[model samples]
Target: MHKSIMIQGTMSNVGKSLLTAGLCRVFKQDGYKVAPFKSQNMALNSYITEEGLEMGRAQVMQAEACGIKPSVYMNPILLKPTTDVGSQVIVNGEVIGNMKAVEYFRYKKTLIPDIMKAYEKLTDEYDIVVLEGAGSPAEINLKQEDIVNMGLARMTKSPVLLVGDIDRGGVFAQLAGTLMLLTEEEKAIVKATVINKFRGDKEILKPGLTMLEDICSKPVAGVIPYVYLDIDDEDSLSERFVRRKEGGLVQIAVIRLPRISNFTDFNALESIEEVNLSYVTSPAQLQEADMVIIPGTKSTMSDLLWMRQNGLEAAIKKLADKGKIVMGICGGYQMLGDTLTDPYGVEASGSLAGMGLLPMDTVFEKEKVRTQVTGQVTSPVGHFKLLEGAAIEGYEIHMGTSSSKSGGISSFSRLEYGLAGKREVKQDGYIMDNILGTYVHGIFDSEEFLEGMVKTLLKSKGLNYEQVKTVDVKAHKEEQYDRLADTIRQNLDIEFIYKILEAGV
Candidate 1:
């Protein structure tokens, strides 16, 4: 039998994901096979598995901490929000359909069987499973059909650790009030409480911790200090968008679309020491950028209209006309074309004018393209020629196909996909002058592609590329995982956690 423990937060972004990942790493280092599980996740940031199935990035990150391959079973149900009220609901890595907030709430209960099936598969394979809960469980209105929090703990027979954010203040009230709100049966499932994101002295907060334990009648397992580690974030609530870094050899600006999905694609580029990346919301921030990247979005047409209304479309066109490097990926790639037609109303009902930087047209389709690809850079012209012949690999997740408006143009890359024993080769994206676009999401993750891009940008600016050192993103992430595990081992009570897992509720 597999032992289980769950981490539930007092509110969203309270370090629940990080703590769960840390526990996963601790268990792995202790010579036990481990896996991460989440019943349902609602986030725009997603990842494509090796099987070409989609799942949330948080579980992906936790799976990495466990030194395991990411699987759709890690995140059984993923909800990618397309608007304020409606979301694209995906079950077991395939799109079921779009649903409104109320509609999904009524329909989510029916997915319990699917969730259990996935969970049982992981339990059968691993010695330990670290589960994560979304949002707060204190919302009385949402507690009825809650398959992700106390309800999941009940279903899985897992012990719970309630986490409260001390950095946001009211840690005691958050933990105490949450327990007060839960039913007696639900409260029994919680074995301990955790205070996360704490700064300053722990001795000063000892009195409050003791009082909190008394009030909640649960042991205080840990008070984790605020530590900075470069890890993937969950969703739009990520602080990476608002942060600004000064002084770098190269400046890259990414357009911050309202419905941006998979912005984590740029994380590898941001890890470079000589590259300063900023998420720009307006034209003013794009002035000094050496390259402007339009990122992926959930709603291509609506976000493109937003760019048009805010004058970013005109500003990007002006930059491209001036011979500045402009690149687009996925939905951003769709926006660089001449026109976008959605006869099936996948995004919107009519045709919309694009930025017209590249000579291509896009048409949204009902079926989404999801796959993992490997390829090499094809023939190129101008400054981008530096990337020619470079090996590249990434995954594709989009709802439309783009093609040349006038016959055909030079492709940005030649892609190959493996199926059974045969290999299928196809061309992807288009390149024109200083503008290029591709549907590949993690195009820069490969060292050859990233180094080539940096060298190209540097050569364009009349600088020596050898002056800047390239980062090995894979090794850097491994170091970060170890650092996170070290912190958790030092601050949290691992022995107590083991006891909780063994004792259960």
Candidate 2:
């Protein structure tokens, strides 16, 4: 018999994704075949599966914790926001169309069938399905048509462990108020309340915990202490974008665009002991960097314009002219080109001049390319000759096609395999002068490519690459999952959680 439990947060960024992932690890460690499920996810950080399908990175992370291959069924619906009030809606890993906030809200309920189809697949295959909720079920306005929170819990018949952020304060109010807002039936689905990110002595907070339990009429599952784990965060709320990490041999400044998507691509670099990776939105931050990276974005044209208006484009161009290493990935790669033309209004209508750092020009098309590819560096290039012949593996998810204007630029990688078993060998990206650009999202995730790039960067600075310790990101992530499982086992009521899972709503 398959059992399930849901983790719903009192608010966004209240550690919902991590908690779900931790639980997945715990269940997997306990010898249960587990998988994560989120009926809907609204985040720009997405991943492409081996089947050439897209899903939220949070689900991908949780799937990793479960030691399972990520599937689109894990996240049936993904909303990639393109504007303040609009988003590109992806259903079952394919883009349906862009929808405004009101339009999506009205049309969301209609996708319930799709959500259930995905959920049933997981239930049939796994012993335990760890479901995650988006935001809070307390949003009374959205509760009526809600398909992600209480509604999803009811649909899947999964008991919930509602989590509150104690570190953010108002742990009592957050937990109690959320319970207060839920209908009696909805409240019944909540098996227990979890106080997440708790610091200070639990003994000192025992009285308050008792009071919270008394008021909410629910068990305090646990007070999870704030853990410092190097996990991939879901969205912009990531502390990685703001936290300062001191002391490193190399400094890489990533241009933080307004709609930065898949910034998690750089987490591998952060794992290296000698590398200091920082997200920079200003010109001042770029001054002392050994390398600058332009990451993927949901709005390429608009973000490029934002950089142009904010002087970041000028600063990066100035750095490039001085022979400094500059790199671009996906949308960032498109921005590095000479021009960006949007004929179908995929991003925005009309053509916009790019950063003019590369000889390529990108034109937005109606079709989005989503595929997994493996390749190797092409011709050896100046400064980064160390990257020559390095193996690379990643995925491409973009709505544009880029080509060299003069056809004089050298190719970066010779990629093999495309969407749906299409056996095609094609050159991807470019390597020219001091610039590098690629549509591959996880370009640095390949340890071979990553180590080679790091060595090249250190070599350019006259530093010994052999002296520095590089990270095996894949192995490191497994260690982190174990660490997270240990932490959860120590703090959370795992026995009770298992009972809750078995008890089914």
Candidate 3:
């Protein structure tokens, strides 16, 4: 008796993904085995599952909320947008080829059986399945062939809970307009409407809520207040990165590029009480920080160009010249080198000059290097020493290999799955002393390495340090899931949701 509910947004960035995760956590706390499902997701941010399959980072985050390893079945179809009108279609974690918007719309309907199969598999194993819908079901132009929203609801006969963002304003119209456009059958499946991201007093929304229920004949489930939980957002509209408070202790500036990826790497740092984290957008902003970090990027060349355009290139050069500590991860690591040669046109507009902080070069290859590795740091840097022989684990998802001539630098350490052998060190790759660049994402998850870096940076500034340690990363995340679940449970209509799941409407 697996009960399910689908949370669909009135529009994109309406907090559907977060809501889905919250519901999954809530149901799980209520003694129900719960999982999250999405029929299709489109984003460049992706994760490689344990089975070596790829899926959207949204479902990956949702899966994290459920305290489970991510699976390709959780997100059966993923579209990584490569161009304005086309995307690289990944079906069941394998690339099928690039397809235009119109082509994908027509092709998506054919995959319904596969989606249903995955859904059925989850239903059999879990007591509850919370499905998240992408974008909106009110796109009348695209409704005829929709498979992500109303169409998926019809397919599973699942009750729908439409969520609207009140913080963005005109939420009433957003919900009212969407309901007005829904087909009779589509409208019938919607059991309740929940207003999300509401700030200020909930009493002020009473009239608006009454009007919405009167017009749509749907009950107002709850008005979710804005909760500033320190969690990762799956998409580009990540408020977690931007909503950070200023700390009076160690100041670290993160260069906010136009196409920043893997920005979630800084979440652990944000949790530290003694660290002040800010996203530096201008050269003037860079001058106030003790250390600077360049995060990963989707298009290294394009982001590099953007850096130059914003005068950040000059700022980075000045910071390095002043002997300030700087670090780069993945594409950010690629950008810290002398030159990046993309002779194969792998990352847009050919080769380009790097920030030149390290004497290394990166060459983009046709194939991507994807793997999960656990190892120790062998470099002379104190941060590396702290991480020496310390069990470290993270995944690598990139399309290039780095080479450096600097002695005492490990080309690749701790080879694990997807890494067949030791990586060769050339005249150019990973360099040490005042700089560290690696293709590994999630490196900050290593407690010894992260805390040490923060302490070292603080000590470099002649400032007193405080040791802040995170207990069990996995447990901390599960606790977050429980908190999110509690929030939804306290606000939403639990009886109605249970009835919908029981009735299979």
Candidate 4:
């Protein structure tokens, strides 16, 4: 059996995921086979693994940091919130059904066997398994049957490193209060405490750190600085969702849907120097943007109705009519069609009249489409006309099928892969004038495609579109992993962490 150490947060977004990833990198760099495990994850942002299995993207990032391929076993249970109270529950990369918060909480303990099975697989394959706990483990009411956090730590005989966010203020209270609230046995597993996302002088914090250590009976392992990393984020709480625009030649505004998913699709575009990308919900924000994007969402019809009720649908239509670039992906692509028919009530009952930007109709199916694909833009339209025959590599994870209905519209791309070995020459996406829509996620991840988009948008503004540098998105992500590992190894007590693993609890 392999040794394991788990990181539990004082609260959500306290850098648990990043720290877990950092440690995974550090362990891997030190020549130990490392893997990350999250017993349960709730996030809108998800990923399809190489085997076509679904998992949380955070584990996927951690897997990359460990120099391993992402596996569904890394994230055993994924709960994607479709409504305020209910979530679509996925187990072992397959959806079981939807469940309310109370329903899931009551039913979760039954899955301890599944969680243990996944955990055992990781322990058998790797020398170190870096486990991450969801939210705070100190929710006193819900800690009874907790399969994550203290419960998981005890099961794996793993020592815990509790992390608290200093940037959120009340860091000492957050750490001490949580430790104090835990049952005596639960508190005993916490080998160390970490103050994350700190800025300014470490000396100023030394006094309080000592007092916290005394109160909690745990050593302050580290005070981690607030560092900007270009890694993939987990959910809507991400800092990227904040609305802010840097002045640039090409302005792009993404419609911030209420139930946005896979918004990381635009991360590559944000890395470009000349592109100013901001997420907007109001109609007024669309006017200043050179290109407006309708991103993927969990509830297509509901979000489309929301856009219509809020006048954003009309605003998008007006912009497209004025020859401004309007593009959509997945559920956003479904919204751009003439109609959206959900016979089985997958999204909602009956059919919804779309924005009519594209002459296509979408029908939701019970079967979800999940696959990584490699293709090329066989043809192009509007601002991206220069990208004809450009090779593209991305993925498709959706439930709706869109088919064009008119002569004026043309296919955006042709797929040579990801059709399950049939060698499909399938045409994806629809193009009509300045309006474009596709179901491919990470389309802009390509250097060829992104550079072409920037140059075209800049030229359309009559600005000199020269001297922009090419960017490799993948290379940047790798560098970020190294940086994160370096930061954590420098600040955190890695020697003690190694000792904790070596002792095997």
lDDT of model 1, residue 292: 94
Ranking by lDDT: 2, 1, 4, 3
lDDT of 4 by residue, 411-448 (tens): 88887545466545577889766888988888888787
Clashing pairs in 4: none
- Report the alpha-carbon TM-score of model 3 versus the true structure: 0.92
Write down the TM-score of every candidate.
0.98, 0.98, 0.92, 0.97
> Which residue pairs does candidate 3 place in steric collision?
403-428, 403-429, 404-427, 404-428, 404-429, 405-427, 405-428
What does candidate 1's lDDT look like per residue over 55-99, in tens digits? Answer: 999999999999999999999999999889999999999999999
* Model 3 per-residue lDDT tens digits across residues 222-293: 988888776677776777656657654777888887667767777778777777888878999887777788
lDDT of 2: 0.92
Superior by lDDT: candidate 1 or candidate 3? 1
lDDT of 1 at 402: 88
What's model 4's TM-score? 0.97
Comparing 1 and 4 on TM-score, the stronger one: 1
Ranking by TM-score: 2, 1, 4, 3
Which scores better on TM-score, 1 or 3?
A: 1
Tens digit of per-residue lDDT, candidate 2, span 404-484: 977634578898866655668888988887799998988888988999889988998999997666677778999999999
